[model samples]
Every structure is written in C-alpha cells, then in structure tokens.
Target: MPQEAGLRSFFLAGFECATQRRADGKRLDLLASTRHDAHVAKDYARIREHGMRAARDGMRWHLIETAPGFYDWSSVAPMASAAAEAGVQVIWDLCHYGYPDGLDIWSPAFPERFARFSKAAARFLAEQGDEVRYFCPVNEMSFWAWAGGDMGRFNPTARGRGDELKRQLARATIAAVDAVREVDARARFIVAEPSINVAPNGDSEQAIADAANYCEVQFAAHDMLVGRLNPELGGSPDKLDIVGVNFYPDNQWVLGGPPIPLGQYNYRPFREMLKETCERYGRPVIVSEFGAENTARPAWLYYVAQEVAAAREAGAPVEGMCFYPVLDYPGWENDRCCDVGLFGDADANGDRCVYAPLAEELRRQRVRFEGEFAAANDERMTPLRREAS
Candidate 1:
C-alpha cells in the first residue's frame, strides 16, 4: 500500500489480450478487437496466476449497452468476479475507443447510454464488494479521438482535431464517472491520456512554442474533463480524480538533437509530471501505463521504480505505476499482437526465446527494488537526461 506517498499503479495487460486478428491481417486495439471478451478472460486468469495487486481492465459501454435500452455485460462480469476472488484491485476502464454498431458521435442519447451502462457496471461490481475500487471512465480520450477520427490510426479514422468528438467523449466520461460513484461511493478514478511530444526540427523559438503547444494539445481533453478548461486556458481538474499519465519509452524527442532510439527514452519526465500534476490538481496521480520496447527491461523497471520513489519523496501523490504486461505475444507488428512483455518468452513448445536475459534481469531488479524508489535528483531536474542503459 504505497497510499501514503500516494504511489500505486495497476498491472495493465491485454490491449489485445483476447482479440483475434482481422482476416486481411490488420488488427485493432483492445476495444475494437472482436476477441475482446475472450482475451479479457485469459488475461484475467493470468493476472490471478501472478498474484498481481491491481489490474487495468475495461468495460466498453458501447458494446454492453448497445441499442439504447438493451444491456449486455455477460462477458465482463466473470473477469470482475475473478479479480474479486484473487483480492486484486480493479481499475476498470469504461471506454478505450470505438463505439457501438449503430451509434453516431453526436447522437442525442449518447450521454444517457454511457451513464446507464456505467451505473449498472458499478452496481454489479459493488455488489461483489471491496475488490474493485478504481475506475478509468475513459482511456486516452484525446488520443483515441485523434487516432480514430483525425489521425486515421484506428477506426472511424477522421482527420484533424474535432471539438465535437472531444466534447462528446468528455461528456460520456463525466457521466460514466458520476454514475459509478452512485453505485459505490468509494470509487476512485485514474483518467488516462497519452502524453505526446512533437518537437521541431530546428532550434528556432517558434519550434519551442510548437513543441509546447503540442504538449498542450495532448493535455486538452484531460484538462476539460478534469474541469480545468475555462480559466487556466484549460484550468479544469474536477472530473479527473487521479490524473492518469501514460508515458512510454517511445514517446520522446530532442529539441535539436537526433531522436533517441525507440527503446532509450528516459523516466525523468514521468517524475517531473507526477510532481507537477500533484501540485496543479492537488490530487493523486497514477502512471497508468509505462514500459519500454525490447532491451534492458530489467533496468527499465528498476529506473521506473526509482523514479516513482523519487516522485513520492518530492511530495507527488503517485498512486501506482504499472508494468504493461507480464509476457509478450508474437506477430505484434502484424496487427495481431504487440510485444510489450515483462516476462521471458517461450515458443509454442514452451521454450525460452528472445529477451531471456532481459526477463531474468527484470526479476532481479523487481526483487532488488522491493517496491522502493529514490527521490528525484536535483542536479538531474532539467529534462535533458544523460543516463543510458
């Protein structure tokens, strides 16, 4: 219970945990994958197997409460039950992107649909009692809208920022969170938003401002959802209870330097963000998602833990930091899967494969750190860090 320093994180897994691949070989994330329900079950089974303390599981409102008045959560319930039995805390995510079969973004019934589904889900879990406390009403609201509608990364791939999409998503999230609380007064939320960085190619002042605005745009929906979009150029932080920060080894840049390789980004910003978020919102923060690609993962976990500890010491209310997954799945790039595993891999015959050394080292570091982290180094406070694995 790192609750005192407000440090704790969910053990998130199953982005495509049970999703089957598209026939043409393209794939969608957890939400869009038709195999979501099955993958969720398998992932929950493994979560119990590992004795993980907390999990970031999702319940897509669009899927469960389609057709306005109809409700169908038969699939997600068993996983919630399993978590309760295992004594693991559940940080349920209400939406990760994607909508129902026939719903439009601007449908008049959108808010009510989300609210009803969220309340039902919450009541269902509350009846189970005590085990599920945390909730993420919507995961990465800005990224999803951008990627799906504007950026064309996922479904409904629309281009450019859509304020209407943003508002609809925020409204649904607010309604869902509010609905859940009605069922369980103790429900806590960690609203996740991907922290993106888009630095300029040159060393001009305009580049600096562009980079700052890039970051600001990433924070917009989160700001509005939290009730901070009005006064402070986006000064709302009410709908957000615990600011859910998702940083990755791939999410970084150089002001004028070469891009760091995918696996080499540092944890300095994570620490700084925790401190700043706590100071700004006066609420606990959660490193909802954090991990690296394919090398020196043990060291990655070690440094992340160290950074988390450092944030806590500095008076940042960090609730928890999560390791994305315990194992990897092959064919990740093919859209069938993504290899963000923390454990060593094995083949169909169960033999050790790539990243064996990294996995072993991760175990060692996890043991060595023993849930402890260091304070943020004052000399290293400036964002440009020199440390490398």
Candidate 2:
C-alpha cells in the first residue's frame, strides 16, 4: 500500500455494458453487451498517465452471462489487464443497470445470476491478481432502481416508489459481495451511491422529516451494502469499506424550489453534503464523482479543493476524490457530459496528446491540497552536506 496519502485521484472507466458507442453508423447502447472493443485498452492507457492510481470501471452481470451457464471474459479482460500492467488499481462496478435482455429482473433467478457473474469475475481477477482489490458491486443502486424501475428513464422501466428499488438493489449488492469473497476473500467493497441533500420548504416539521427520510433514502444502498437494513430492510448491515458518493450540483435541490442554475451552486453546498454523509455513516468517504460544466473551471477547482480540505479537517475519513472523466464523453444530456472531460477531444488519428486547461486546474487544486514540493528546498527529504567530511 502506498502509505495512505490521505487523498487520492482516480479516473473513471465505464464498463463495456455502460458504454455508448458509435457503431452501425449510428450510436448503439452497449449497457448489456458482452463484446469487448480494442478502443477501451487504448483509452485506459491514456487515462493512466493522468496521475490516477484507481480507475472506476463498470461490470454488468447481464452482459457477461447473457444466457444461462454461459460465460465470456473477452470484453473486460483487456481493460483489467491494462490496468494491472499500468500499475493502476481498479474499483470494479458490477451491474450498473439492466438485465441480460431475456431475464426478468423480478424473477427469483436475478440474485443468483448476479452472484455467479461476480464470483466468476473475482476468480479470474484473483487468478491474475496484482493490485486489483476493490469491488463496487453496484453503482448508485437507489437512483438506478428509481430511474430504471420507478422513473422509467432507462430499461426495465418499472414504475414504483423507493422501497422496492431499495430492496432489490440491496439484495443484489449482498449477493455480489458474497460472490467476490468466494473468489477473493481479501477484496474490499466500495459502495458508490448518489448523495443528495433535499432541502425542503422552510423549517416546518414535515420538511424536517422529509429531509431525514431523504437522507436515509439516499443512504439505502450504503446501508444495505454494509448490512444496515435492521428492522426495516429485514437483514443485517453489509460491510462497506468506502462510502463512494456521486454528487453533482443538480442532485442537491429544494422540493419544488426554483432550480439553482449550474453556475450558481458553490463549494459550500458540496462541503456540507460531504460532512453530512460522513457524520451520518461514520465511514471513510470518497467523492467518487465530482465536476461541473460551462464555466471557468479553475475557480470551480479551487473551491472544490477548499471544500475537500475542510472535509478532511473536520475529521471525515475522506480517502480520495475522483474527477469522473479525463476526457469528454459525447451525447450525454444537456451537453454536460461533453464538458465534464478534462481533455475535451483528440486529434484525427484519435491520439490524445493535449490536456485541457481545466485538467491543469484540476492538477493545480490537487497540489494545493496535497502540498507542493520545492525540488531543492524541501527539508523532509535531502542529502547530507558533503563538506562536513
């Protein structure tokens, strides 16, 4: 282990299933595909150069074993291998969303299928075991269930309230952990979920209750992953190594309150949320995903770094912070996706050689938080004076 630097920077790697690829002369969704692409390996190499020790990659159970008892590792193996070779660690996300297409999510076989895929993935990785140790069984389970199951945003768009989604996602998380432990008992699980602070209408009692419930609701995934269900969720709390928070400005909002424009949301709001999450869970926190769009991002960078420092000073076990993407992704909602990348795009040959100023700003902020080193002036490490002899 690299002496627990107290803060870390990581790159995001969307799994084969979650990637939206330009193909068939048009964009095709690969959220449930098992086929791997060569481009991913190339991308990983580029990402590794950006000072990331950890990479957040997604893994879909549905894609790996599309049919009963059938398995395929071709899609993920290269990227995992690439990460290992590059000396980068991976926090593999299993089952971001959707089923293998034929199976119903409500079916009894869902949990077992997920477990099988996880176990197989863990086994293979362990067989090749280098530094790959962390596993995030599911990413943002509460939001996914709500969006996919309740809100109908993505596939398997079943509409329901918060409870069902919470329950099913929790079960899947449990099964996933069990599977991984079967293969690698020492594997650490990072539970990544959306952390939203719902500011209700004024200080009314109902509003307070609503806010509390909302906190718990967002915590549903973390609670279950660490086995915290208790009297309500019907099981013990699962073990959570890191509480991964995917927070964007949009996620923090008031009930029916006028939307706070993206530029208006500041670092204070994020700091408070980070503090609250730490206070609530009493676990080490990682701002798993954080970034903004359409502005002078260096200012944004300075502000976020200040807030992260505050989180650390306040005694929150904030282990690391990840900027989500090193390059912009095409066609995400509201052009926000395109803007989030630190490197906007590449040259004609797809060779990524330029770093956007925003990335420089990110680097700048990291240095401020981690402290700067003067090449020949620092006293913590130095050579003895030869004149003494």
TM per candidate: 0.77, 0.82
lDDT of 2 by residue, 87-183 (tens): 6677787776645756666666777788787888888788777544778787778777777677665655567744676677677777778778877
Candidate 2: segments with Cα more than 4 A from true spot: 1-37, 230-238, 261-268, 332-337, 346-348, 353-355, 373-389
Task: Give the per-residue Cα lDDT of candidate 1 at 389.
Answer: 26
* Alpha-carbon local distance difference test for all models: 0.59, 0.61
Per-residue accuracy of model 1 over 100-130 as CA lDDT, tens digit each: 6565656757767777778888887777765
User: TM-score of model 2 relative to the true fold?
Assistant: 0.82
RMSD of each: 7.8, 7.8
Backbone clashes for every candidate come to 27, 8
